[model samples]
Target: MARVSQEHLDARRRQILDGAAICFARNGFHATSMQDVLKEVDLSAGAVYRYFSGKEALIAAIVEEVLGQVRDGFEEAALSSPPPPPDLLVSSVLGRVLESKEFLTVDGRPAFPRLVVQVWTETLRNDQLAGILHDGYSAVQKTWGRIVEAYQDTGMMRSDISADRVARTMMAAAMGFLAQQALFGPAPHEILRDGLRALMSVRDPYDTTGGSQLG
Candidate 1:
């Protein structure tokens, strides 16, 4: 007769989402069913349905959770006390993608990349999922656009290039790197570190000759 506490309800929702993520990560979203999620969670049909109406709802929740973390990561970097160097900021964000426990499979592989590919494929068929992904990417691009403008104003980045262009380019590069990592294993951190340095015009740490300096 006792009512479920708010914390308990939230925990249950998270449990269901986690199980769904694992299922979708292993099997493509189209191949995954509500029954698969129920079995993964070891919960009854009614119990799982209480949190998510169906597989689509569960996929939405998973995408939102992943996108939320990405947005928060960029926001945090932008608002740092002493703003991180461009290369560091980019490296830091990508590094977290490599390190995030939430994205890892039980066998210690990065599951997010596979999930991302599945989501992209599903977006072709599912309008709702496409909209959700579009909104998430828009939010991230807007935040990065602001950050790029701020860097330009500070002379840390080239003012000649458009902030919107730079933001889009950066996002594309990040996504490309993630896709590569997800398909293969983790990439050397130095590859991303150096790549961001070149893209953002950050000064090379190894170059002691101060011919070209970064703001």
Candidate 2:
């Protein structure tokens, strides 16, 4: 038997990963069978095994894809603006969620919060999954921390606060709000805006004009 080329393997991997995401998000990580994913991707059982040995492997790949996209979004947002605002970060992150109406109801109820909860809980149970998720999140937080430090350097953030600490605190608040939004029907944007305004109050008032000539 001939070995598949890397490009072919990558393409097949993406197909499998995408199908697995839809399956896991719909049927949950624990409940989604390998057969379900194979059926979703129209792959033969042998082909599925060739790509991912087990359901766990498929789930991990799906999580990696989701988190990888998130990390890329953050990095792009940071580079797009020299010192991105807290509100921009919050909006861009949550906007991804809001854009997926399949995952959000008309009233802002997350359609797949259970799937998210399942993945998060499974991470706690599996060291490998936990490590993967943590690494992705650590990268995200570090990027935000760098942005926070940049803001401080530009005199837009409070001088007394640690950038890392501020990043952690803001991420915590954002995560908590997302969890609440998953459970409740409140708009995340409004909640995030008000919360960011409160957080930024610690520093001197900076107008929205990108720190240009302040009167």
Candidate 3:
């Protein structure tokens, strides 16, 4: 038999990861069996081992992959054209959360969200995961912070407002909204839009009614 090149190995690994994503997203990480993924991808159990050591490794890979996409998305949004509006900044972050559903359709409803929620809980118990999740959140905050700074520079926001603080608060609000959505199952975009409106309102503190302040 001929040897497979590194490229071939990596391609196969990606395929396995894709399968694992579907499994994790659908079945919930704990509920998914290696055999389930193997069957989904039509790969033998032994063959799958060549790509991942075990189920836990597969879950970690999925986390790393999804989180990487989110990080990349936020970075890309920073470079996005038209200069991000405050509402759009929140919209972008919320959009990414909703996009996790793309991976969830593979196994079951609430699959990827459930896994991420579990990871959030696990972070409370595991220092390493906590650090990873925390850093990921910080990256999100920084991305939004840059957008807020841009808005401030253009006079869309109050010059005195701190972009970093606003960004951190927005992301924190987003995390809370995600938790709420997971619990209540309101329309996905509903919380996102509402949240963005609330965040944007901070920039406009006065209303036609003298007593009404946006902030």
Candidate 4:
């Protein structure tokens, strides 16, 4: 018997993952099962099991793939000679989130945010999943923290506050945006960018008079 080529094996693995992603997105992690995945991918038990042992394994893989994009998004920005300002950084990152195909469902809905809500709920009961999520989030936070530190050095951000706190606060805003996106319909990226700019701006965009400034 001939062996399967490496490309074939890789393709099959991705097929299983893609099918699993759809199942989880549509039915959620708890509602989705191995049998559902089997039906979704039209694969036998043995074929699917060869790639993933169980549902959580598939969840971990998919979550890692999703979070990896978030983690890697900060790479080039983190190394800039003069780090991006906080509002620009937030806007740019959220803009990418809005544009990424990974963040959309087959039906073009922003289901990625909804999927993240499910993962957070699952983490309460699944320690391993929590660990996976925590590690990924921490990595992303560190990237933010690095930028915050640079901002402080350049006197762009306050030097009195801790970079970790600033990073965590920014992460909170991003998470809140995701929750809002998931709960509501599609929101324009300008909402994030403009909002951040408004919060940081000394002059109120609405105030036409130069004498009137934002507090």
Ranking by TM-score, best first?
A: 1, 4, 2, 3
Rank order by lDDT, top first? Answer: 4, 1, 2, 3
Cα lDDT computed for each candidate against the true fold: 0.79, 0.71, 0.67, 0.81
RMSD of 4: 4.5
Model 1 residue 5 CA deviation in Å: 1.8
Cα lDDT tens digits, model 1, 67-159, are: 887888888877754456667777788677557645547468767777777888899999998999999989988888888877866766657
Q: What is the lDDT of residue 133 in candidate 1?
A: 94
TM-scores for all predictions: 0.86, 0.73, 0.71, 0.84
What CA RMSD would you report for each candidate?
A: 4.0, 5.6, 4.4, 4.5
lDDT at residue 192 of model 1 (Cα atoms): 76
Which stretches of model 2 miss by more than 4 angstroms? Answer: 1-12, 97-113, 185-191, 198-215
Q: Please write out the lDDT profile of model 2 over residues 1-215, one tens digit for every residue.
A: 99879999899987787677667756677787888888988989998899788988877776676677667777777675455678767766766754553432323344444455567878878999999889988997998787787777777765567788988887777676766755564565666877777866653356565544322
TM-score: model 3 vs. ground truth: 0.71
Model 1: residues with Cα > 4 Å off, grouped in runs: 106-108, 188-190, 198-215
Reference-based lDDT, residue 67, model 4? 78
The residue pairs that clash in candidate 4, if any, are: none
lDDT of 4 by residue, 46-111 (tens): 999998999989999988987787777776689995677777777687778557645447467766
Report the CA-based lDDT of candidate 2 relative to the real structure: 0.71
Greater lDDT among 3 and 4 belongs to 4
List the candidate 3 regions with Cα displacement exceeding 4 Å.
Answer: 2-11, 22-42, 80-82, 100-103, 106-110, 202-215
